[model samples]
Target: MTPPDLSVYRLVFRLGDALIRSGASSATTTKALLAVCTRAGLKHPSVSVTLGQLMVSDQPDDGSPPRTRFHEIEPGALDIRWRTRAEEITEHYLLGDVGLEEALEEIEDQVNQKPSHQWWKLVVGYGVLGTGFGLILGGQPLTAIGGALTSMVISFIFRILGHLGAPGIFGYAAGGFVAVLAATALNTAFSLDQVAVCIVAAIAARLAGIASYGAVQDAITGWYISATGRMMEVATSTAGLVAGVAAGIGAVRLLWGPSVQLIETVEADTTHWTASILGAMFVAAGFTLASGGWAVRLLALTGLGGATELVYLFLLEVGTTPFLSITVSTAITGAACVLISRPINLSSNAIMMVSLMPLFPGMLIYQGLLGSLFGLEDSGATLLEALITAFCLSVGGVLGQYLFSEGLWLARRRQFHHTHPGESFSKVMPEEYNSRDIMLPVFSKPFNGSEARPAGRTPKGRPTADA
Candidate 1:
């Protein structure tokens, strides 16, 4: 095997880096990188994805010093435009239609792609997100209106922070703190019954899904370092959010007459199914706007949101616990993403990720943290339950992917290699190859639903199967 041209190596590096910074999971990014290189007919191209950097190299079979290239990556900010364009560039290259200059131009275009909607439009979308969450949780009219107001405040803070180019951690923390402060004030001013739902909704659009699906995939594939880094990023962002909310609530109590009650907002079984589905749609559309995704994708995600929430409701009706209900709900969503995304030219990463917005434990984090601080009854238990719920989500996502998509991914790789000799598989492709890879003897083919490989991985990050 000969070394790839230095320009091709550089293009590959840029492509992988763009995917990472655009919030593609380690597995998806890695797989996409390998696919592009293989299609480009590069020999023994090597790529390593770390927390803050991406490295790609071309190694000759002769064993001389390999030429390598790298890029420093800021933590990802979800922009579906980047991922979509990257996929196009890769597929175009694979079809043998793109030249080096075209690939470079594509990368440049992606890096500079602006949001599909205006800034003010995003603010309104976030407001809709808060309103949706409030309705889903059965908030009263006052609570729903207050939630929208609070979301606007949070959006304003984020915009200012973004304009100033502030550090991500501080910006997130500030948004959380301000959102709580706004909600509490609104609750007092309106003489509302409970502010918990309002506050949760205000920040619903901001809760970052744990890239745990990516962590699961990385750990499964023996990339422990990258896995740890990915998990830590999620933890740190969540901590910032918790601290900000805690501080904001504490400050309000100190300055005001009384402490804000840490009410556990619970909806009765009679909470309307239609309301849940509609609210889920609102949340999904809001997320797409806030994150700079295209309008067409939003239509699909909105429908998916409704369908998945119905699944969650069905599980609850069948007497499922909260943890189990969430797991099953996520599993259904994961399966839908796997079956639906490819034909539509959508990135599964974005769809599975935003689908989690309706189910994430945003309010629970605030209630648990404040409850413990105030020495409220069962506060400690609430906190413990919150942690358990999070663990369940991560586990569910991993299981969903394994059950739905991993086998198909493996089978596809096997078949591709069998048909086209001398092409290296993605790094996610296991080292050991057997007849199962070529024929999928162990699992069903894509969209077949014939084989049950037990519960699987992937909720958001790589849909648990890359998991």
Candidate 2:
């Protein structure tokens, strides 16, 4: 039988890369691929895959003649094929597993082949995410609109930077800092609510760093790939945010006296239920539009955010410190995330971003900065508190993730024991596939009254099945 087309294999590889990057479970990724294949009118497209077996070829180029080969298939049987040059195979063995840099290079090569307009899809998606963030931060409608627009523009600029082969970290930081500074200045000059404007800016900036899928997958499978990427992304974005805020504040300090307060005090709203619900809806709409997510999914995410905020408000009303409130709320959010793992396709990064926004201690940070500009002695204490609050937020989020994952593991063990009576889970749980044995068949082919044939080889001196 003719081997499956190379284009199909390429498509699978691309989809797999995206699924893996997005932190989707293998089972979910497989199911989604099946659905896509079905939609595309493909036949017998169901394929079994072992994780890590689908790695990008890392063989080096050497001056030699290229080689290509085809595999054979029995009538009505599946055909699998692979291609490699001898030099590439040698290099692949020499290099061992390919690193992220190599993987990204491969991805870039493939992406470059597609129409340029495809990049806009990513921009639009991130823009929506930013807008949702703005609405959640209690920005006005216009602020949300502006933030989304600005995020899209920045995304395009970042794309250009990428095309120019700029360092990703520098590009992301520069883009994010510029966006935030611009938004902050616009808000301050026009007497717009700086807190709301900051929220919108922060959301836009933070979207550029969101890593929900990676964090979740890392938490689930003990993989560091997702975890490290997430940490780096968060750290860089935070640096950008700090830099932007500093720049904007510095400009204000220079023009006005250092003693002038950039922020004006406003009365806190006492009405809760109506405003909260409306705000939640606004957040939902913004996110739905930004992420290109389903309305139901957006609503669910908004509900979660609103509910968490209400809990924090309650804790605050009872004299809880902002630090403690954020800590507890984040822990709760993390626990919920672990419990509702599959249903909440929302990334932990995304959820964490939204949940933390309302209680970000931005006001405290601003106050501390203001005090510092005026050289207030007590400013040291305020700044310390501000730093502590930020520390607590990070700690709470990490603690939540750890506790929830551990709890899930324990629960799974308990369930296993309950089902197996005296049996231990260690014995019952299947061992993870090792790289050496992943492609080895799990079941022997059914006896066909013929000797087993090597993959892609036709039995010699026998009547061909096709004949």
Candidate 3:
């Protein structure tokens, strides 16, 4: 009985930890680590991935004790840059371009890399994002300017709170509070008719659309635990936002009187297709710029955003319900993101995030929260409608992603099983593993270097094929 080499286990754990921190789902994490193990010559490695933890274990061919390692993942900011780099390292490792030690070093470097862009870009991006949504929500030029200013303030607050290690709820609540307070003051001072639109736009970036989409995608991939965790996140953030809006409204009401109106919902001006399309583009560009994305990807996503908004407007003009219209547009945008991600050199999540920004129901949620607070007769109905809309958006994105990506994943897993017989679903990392194929080798042989290489080593450099 010999001691098993722990380097392979460590590598799997490291990669999985990076992906999880980058918000990869449990299924994805499992599939990715398993693929790495399988390619590295491990016979049957086991992987378990949750939102905040990753575990990897593998049996040695020499019949030594099975080696296992676990890592606790601290989720970080949603940065497509880091996520893409991590995946590329995995791909390079699988291609035999780097040995186990080199792969580990690369992962470490990626983890410690500084952000590509400075902080002020994010503030500007948020301003543009708010202005775009303001126009989309039927606000005039003044409202757009007001919303942009408010968004810059919210963005600053968000960064400061994040740096200070404040709770997410506090950031969301603070943003909501500021948005409402600013809009109320502006409306009162200038008699603005679109104050509600401005407030909604200012807080649009804080919505839980990404989390909602992740929750549905995790559930679809059979990662129920991860799905539940994401759902809880969505609920908490949204509740915090609603509470903040309520507090803001209360403070404003106290300052003025009960008769002092704050938020005034206006009918969406769909006839301004030009403004709507441009608004969507601005939203997309703003998100990309703020996230430190590249210029080429920003332009591509901006185009995608405008195209999606066009589809939404066309659907509305043709008499589809607003909910249905957004759902369709979001699905189309998701599919487009998947298709174009490779060409644009952007992760699908990055493209999807920007492409679907125009469709988030921030306005609906704010309006519903305001109504509920004031005890409007239709408040319950508006809130229900908002919930349904969020659900529909999630479903649409999940379905779109599944159509292009996950369905093919199942096919490949089945193909691998048929070819190899009894490999246990080819050890796919779902919602997490950077997928290329289940059992396919990225190169003719594994990289040979230090003793840290994967198992099944013989005199030759080639790894023995899986049984």
Compare candidates 1 and 3 on lDDT and give the better one.
3
Off by over 4 Å in 2: 1-153, 180-232, 244-292, 344-387, 394-411, 418-423, 427-467
TM-score of 2: 0.52
Q: For each candidate, what is the lDDT?
A: 0.66, 0.45, 0.69
lDDT of 1 at 211: 64
Ranking by TM-score: 3, 1, 2
Please name the candidate that would achieve the greatest TM-score relative to the true structure.
Answer: 3
At residue 423, candidate 2 shows an lDDT of: 37
Residue-level lDDT for 116 in candidate 3: 50
Ten contiguous residues with the weakest lDDT in model 2: 75-84
| Candidate 2, residue 415: lDDT | 68
Clashes of 2: 1
Candidate 1 all-Cα RMSD: 7.9
Error of 1 at 135 (Å): 1.4
RMSD of 2: 13.4
lDDT of 3 by residue, 1-467 (tens): 12224667667777776666555655555656666776666755677766567767666665777667778866455566766777777776765678777887888777677875457888888888888988887788888888898889888888889899998888889988887888777766777766677788888767744556656767776677878877777677777877888888789788866665566554456899999888888888888777767667778878888998899899999999988887888887777766776676555655676688787777777777778777777767777887888777767765676566655556766775565454344233221122444222111111111113223322234453432
Which digits, one per residue and each the tens of the lDDT, describe model 1 over residues 52-130?
A: 7887765555577765777787776566666666667776654446766688777877666665445786788788888
TM-score of 1: 0.82
